[model samples]
Target chain A: MIGIVGGLGPYGGLDITKKIIDETAARSDQEHLPLLLFSCPNLISDRTAYLLDKSNVNPGKAIAAILRQLEMAGATIAAIPSNTAHAEPIFSVVQDERARMGSTLKLLHIVYETVRFVDENYPDTTVGILSTAGEQICSLYREAFIRKGFVVVEPEGSQQEKVNNAIYDEDYGIKAQPVPIANKAREDLLLVMDDLKKKGAQVIILGCAELPLAIPERDYNGMIVIDPNRILARALVHSLAPDKLKPL
Target chain B: MIGIVGGLGPYGGLDITKKIIDETAARSDQEHLPLLLFSCPNLISDRTAYLLDKSNVNPGKAIAAILRQLEMAGATIAAIPSNTAHAEPIFSVVQDERARMGSTLKLLHIVYETVRFVDENYPDTTVGILSTAGEQICSLYREAFIRKGFVVVEPEGSQQEKVNNAIYDEDYGIKAQPVPIANKAREDLLLVMDDLKKKGAQVIILGCAELPLAIPERDYNGMIVIDPNRILARALVHSLAPDKLKPL
Candidate 1:
């Protein structure tokens, strides 16, 4: 059974779940894919706070506990839909959980999966990233892309502020509201995307799940905005259940 | 943590999950409700088949197994969203599981809860039911309402056929598509509602989860069409997390 470890900013969880439903060609209810979702929003500590502030709470250990919960329930293959949660610390904790609880749950790592998709599909060597400051400070995407032999570019100076404003704006941040598409946030997001394009970055990665709410599927002018959540979902369908991919 | 036992039909599972999200007054991800969903569409045998055909596979046994899976994973409160799954046999199996495993999972019985909702809300004594043939043969809603001292009215022979057609129509059925509103089914569903209204049913019930898909919320002319799924969801929120309802 496929287990979805979510509740990391609930909208992302809902977005990926809905995408899975839309992607599958289920004419009737019985025809759809079997899924198990463990939505522990409060259980896991905030990745941004933990990573940026060196908070006492270990998000990695919390994630491992949630994964162990899924394994106990009967999930052979599972996924934590948060890109920021797929860092090395979380992976290490997962290993620890596997050792302690004897868990065999194979996680679909969103960051690695998105990078793989980029490597295979896009020819660009330098990619722009739009993500939370936590991911930026953690060098989450930068180090991974560098290991894959690609140069990564992020918004510099005030341009970075605009991206952060669009993401963390109380009324307009992608996580602030039920629907993430606010006019003000969209306007600011467009500026950030344009600045990234001007900075010699060929492709942009919407590393934050909430980013897609402002910058739609084809918002960027000719530049590919890789939504890691969508990529993770596609990778999951392709790897775990390829036949479900036929509808999309 | 709340565990949702769904995928008896995929959309119902999604609908309830979405309702929980919508009902909550969560500004950010952390404040939202914690939910674990096991969408085991293939695992449970068809309810109608088991209820009518004397099928060897017991739906009660399947539901019990799913509930057991949830309890094993750390779900203290659990609910099965399927209306027809609350039959005597299913309850018996649930009792058996609880006895065998010493389960402390508090199950929200959808049928009983819905009946209680009707008892407390509407002053009118008569009600109409639009549901699947399985529910009709098993007298699921009718018996429950009768026990509550409410007069129950079902669609007539031809009218019942039309209701069933609107619900089970391969292409037009609510379960046939992700979004329940279908034009052809809606047209026929209106006729069924009008017939029930003419029969002096003070309130009409979308007894089957799929019925609400074909018949929109406001199609019952002057009468109230009770959606049991929404009622179940509301009951859950009210009982489990009253604080979350502040935003709504």
Candidate 2:
């Protein structure tokens, strides 16, 4: 059973859980249906907190509370889908919760799973990353991929701004009308991808979740594009049932 | 710091770790170099073990020993690259190691991060998976993605055989030269991919680590491809330092 510590962003948590269920492989009789438990608390947003430099409500406790609930409900393994919540202090609360749960439940790290997937599948591939300026400049994908022997590519100055605008613009997630600013952001990603391809990038990773919304799979050229959420789902299934996953 | 628990397959472990470093984001001032710890305990090969089922090896203990070493070396976080080693008993050993390490270290699951990356980036899309019969018949990705709302597709019988042959055929990984059997596997994957595209799959996921070797991005059609290992590397970067990863 899988318990999802989510709701950092309503859509992201739900999307990740759904991906896990959708991508997991099932046997003829014993299908892998993870019991999902979600918690979406009204915590301060990471974007607003980071940009404004204000005291933001930490969602870690809320995440822990949700995990406890999942444990009670028979969830054996748990994972949080929010990337920002992985900060040391925030994850500490989660660790504490797992400790309290006493070995029955496993708390899975979202980022580690993502990096492991890449290493196992795309050894020596040069990859272009599209992510928040925070994720890009701080050495998120850059640090791990470089260590693993993959080449990490990023968009330059103005193009990065375009990507940022697409994510933070108020009209970005309106869900009805298409915003011109967001469209420009999508176009900017294409330009970056093209440049990366020219530089011999075999794969382009959408480092930020929001970036995938701007550049759908259909728009990409022949380059392989990786979205971490899907990879994590497959990993979860494997973790939950390794013996059942033996190949023929 | 990220500690890789590798060498499960000798060179494959080194190869995976190298890929993570190479693909991660880095800068002039800050570098994302992880603390890597490896243990290569020789054992009967996975292919042989699966085929003969006569090995007296304990993959769980091997992984547990590595985790213990990483924690003692002061690794705050850890991940394992071997897919088959994720069985429950093996992971249980890992959990025990975390507990013994004063519970300060976090063991990251590769599948969880992969799902989170996809959910963050690609919200509503259809994805096709190419993996070992173990992964596919076991329903590793299918259940997870379905829960997340992404459509999951798999190859049929003969295609599955082709994929398996491509990876395990004596001429491929074991031999220096390319073989006709390996080419047949690649061709079969392409045919399955075309079928998936016709069935509305927007992205094709190379779920099995070996499948990436069978299909190259250049030869693929315009569809987006996902390599799980690369996604895992990016996710690890995000896990280690979320705040530092800002776009320039």
What are the candidates' C-alpha RMSDs? 3.7, 17.5
What TM-score would chain B of candidate 2 score versus the native chain B?
0.81
Candidate 2's displacement at residue A11, Å, is 38
Worst 10 residues of 1 chain B by lDDT: B172-181
* DockQ for the candidates, in order: 0.56, 0.02
Question: Candidate 1 lDDT, tens digit per residue, A92-117?
Answer: 67677668887767878777887888
| TM-score, structure 1 vs. true | 0.84
TM-score of 2: 0.45
TM-score of each candidate structure, all chains considered together: 0.84, 0.45
